[model samples]
Target chain A: MAKQFKSLHPTKFYRDYLNHDIRPDGRLISKFRPVIINIGSIATADGSALVRIGKTTVICGIKAELCPPKSERPNEGFLICNVDLPPLCSSKFRPGPPSDLAQITTRFLADLILNSACIDLKDLCIVKEKLVWCLYADIICLDHDGCIIDACLLVLLTALKTVRLPGVEYDAAIDKKTINEDEQKSLSIYNTPVSTTYAMFEDKVITDPTAEEEEISSGLLTIVVKNKELCSIHKPGGSPLSEEKLYDCISETINHADLLITLINTAVAEQND
Target chain B: MEGKQRSNVKFVFLKCGVVSQAKGSAYFEVDNTKLIVSVYDPREIPKKTDYSSKGELFCIFKYAPFSCPNRRAHQPDADEKQHSAIVKRALESAVCRHEFPNFQVDVYILVLENDGSALSGAITAAGIALAQAGIPMYDTITAATLAIQGTTKLLDPTLEEETLCTVATHKSDTEIDYDSHGIIVLAMLSTHEQISEFYQLGNLDLETLNESVNILMNAAKDIVPLVEKCLVDYVTKTLKSNAES
Candidate 1:
């Protein structure tokens, strides 16, 4: 009987739970899914992390390669971030090409990482205008659940924290270099930015909505926080909320970000070097 | 040398022999999956101030707007970019880079239709295109793909089979018991039996993966004769046209 009503009137079913100040998953409206983080599992990658928020699982692997720095930015290296949502993750995605959602998430994450100054590009430079390190950070979604942005954000940050840069001996005149992997240095992260996603359907707002809830929602907002400061408020145009409500979401996300940072730092420290 | 500052980048031919910089081009078709590849001449590495002792190869893989069910963007997406990287890696070992120092060769692959095994197909077609362009190569390259669901290994999976290996369908009433399913693509040098690139996705145990590699190699070998025959035909046709002209 409950399944019939849920399949027939999904919005009404969710509304019933929301009115009762609880969610169908036995959590409060402001509650979030449990996050499980694992770091440095992929040995091939310089840094790697797998994060799970509820059923949404995302793995981020960072591979470092050497290339000449761009002429305009000779002192800085490159950071290329790509998110792949393959058919293995879910049936909604196909095998041939990346879906629209995959592209959008990738672009959004790249933008956020840049704006937040999470990792300074200058740190990746090996030699000015001659040789530099290019970090290819690839985030693959293994399972499609709800609130993937939060998981992707956490996993990316965690992966970045685990990165170790190798020492290189450079000959600027000949433009050749030899790597010394024995002398490794960890990355210096500038900021730890974490995000929280909220779905607003009608007037009621729910935090860390599931995939089903996201569909029923008319508006979705993601708030990114760096420490106590709000870094980004990404609302890709859904129902607009009042200023008071937006402030409330930001406050909640700031608190959530603090909690996530502590958890991530502990996980990083626990990982074997 | 006496002229004003000129653009270093060359915009070669538009058509095969016309005003294009590309030296060689080839079109490949396998069932509904069709693609075209063009190889450009070795040129100075553009916008690179540093010197390279050996040449570099850059590949771009893209699909047409209507190639698949959904509309593709003009810019290459993550999958296409990754495909380009794999193709580059597969072809990198085959090419003799010492011949073209401080230069770069650009290979462009455009898939007109996507049936299945597009990446493997792109590798095979790119190899042919490189050869047709008179690029230095160690040996001919070939590739194949395999789809595994449980114990059933489907060689050269169609689009539907590929999807099946990707993820179980939502419409299926019963739960899929056996969790093993995956697709593997292997690119190899058929003459020397050297595998250049191997890519896999899905949840398959190591045992299944080991068996799947053998199956893919066999399938790749089966296609070698066709590729050789196609190249022989291309050479003969060109020779005949030269005689006539």
Candidate 2:
């Protein structure tokens, strides 16, 4: 019925549907779409993965390089994340540089990953106060059907899980020049944090909105969960959301996070085999 | 005194902030062939032309001094300009220009390494840079250079192959011997199976030309899907990370 009325405003229709505890996509107020994940697809990258949430798609690749540890955190390695949304993904994106939106999203994702302590920085240290592995996680958006933040996090987690460092070889014959690939090890991960996004339109909250739904929504909230613990909360646009609604969203995110973790673990396990 | 010569060439893509001023920048290396491509964005149009129906895209291809084996001149040379024109045409056909009406997308490519098919490398670099910049297009364009030697066609021909192909074809002066006259480089659009751009430096017979196109097109078709998958995978990760954050 909603698809038939192309000209009708989604916000208005969503509001009407919310009164009856339903969504236009035939899901309940808290329901999410099906998700699919694949890992270790890019052989060139140290670690990589591809994830899909309904029609939305994302890919994340991690490259590890040896570098000097930070002066402040000499015993630990560093992690940096970048997000690229090329014009080919959508008509709204233009060719040029990263837009303001992309910058914000990149920073936010980086903060979440760092704060969540998903990776153990100490294990990345090759030499105390000297050398460490600087892991660069580059995430790219190929399609923007909707629910971008959730899709991005899924790919990142899947990539990290599937990645294995090449063996590092210390060549005694060559003045201790180490061959990084010969002595490789897996990254030490403490916990996996999965993310979920919700769009609030006219007091009704929708889970994993599509691009069309996102465009019409007034505000969005992204919740990250690690092992049943809420690790991060991002509510861009500063729209007022009640504590009750926030808790509800978190509960729903935690539930979906379990499903996502299962999907990611299964994909990684398949790759290992 | 006949020894086989083999070239050891490797290419890697690095996310370097060389073009800090630009929105998205990437450094590409194919053995000694190094280049940096930067994407700007849908910025205000500088020209006073009323082509405001959609966004405008501008491409600038330059070769840095000392890029080649020879000591290059200080100013932009004629060959550089010609290469830039070819690259611009190839990109223009691949990108959807009508997406941005009043704004312009600027792609600046600086070649730091000059091996054979620098233009083709620059085109590929530009495509990646554009994707990094987050501009919306229908698909990513992947390009490869071909050298036809009699019945054999080589992909990503090295500098030695470049010279050999030139000599093998150019030395033949007669019109009937034109098929052996030189090599052809084609820039193809992989998705639609269309030839977005083509460049042939040497003379070739019509039959040879048709055969070369077919060979190159088939090779390009094989490569297009790989590039598309790469782009798709990249974007999917970015979105997932965003959601997680």
Best by TM-score: 2
Candidate 1 Cα errors over 4 Å, as ranges: B1-245
Residue A190, candidate 1: Cα error in Å is: 1.3
Model 2: residues >4 Å from true position, as ranges? Answer: A1-10, A16-20, A169-176, A180-183, B1-48, B51-88, B91-144, B147-152, B156-184, B187-196, B200-245
Q: Per-candidate DockQ versus the true complex?
A: 0.02, 0.07
For residues B1-245, write the lDDT of model 2, one tens digit per residue: 02332222234444433343456666666655666677776778875667667676677666543345343443557887787788778877777778777887877676644666667777767776777677776656666676666655566676666777776443346554444445566777766767778888766767878877776666656555545555666678779989996
- Candidate 2 lDDT, A1-273, residue by residue in tens: 646554576567667777898866687867788898977655456787878888676777677777778899989987788776655455576655777767888888888887888888787877677567787777766566777878887888778777687655333345353665566577766788888888888777888887877888889889888889888988888468899999998898888878888888788778777
**In angstroms, how far off is B238's CA in candidate 1?**
66
The Cα RMSD in angstroms, rounded to one decimal, for candidate 2 relative to the true structure is 11.1
Candidate 1 Cα deviation (angstroms), residue B243: 82
DockQ computed for model 2 against the true two-chain complex using alpha carbons: 0.07
* Leading candidate by DockQ: 2
State which candidate has the highest lDDT.
1
Alpha carbon deviation, residue A172, candidate 2 (Å): 11
Query: How far is each candidate from the true structure, as Cα RMSD in Å?
Result: 22.9, 11.1
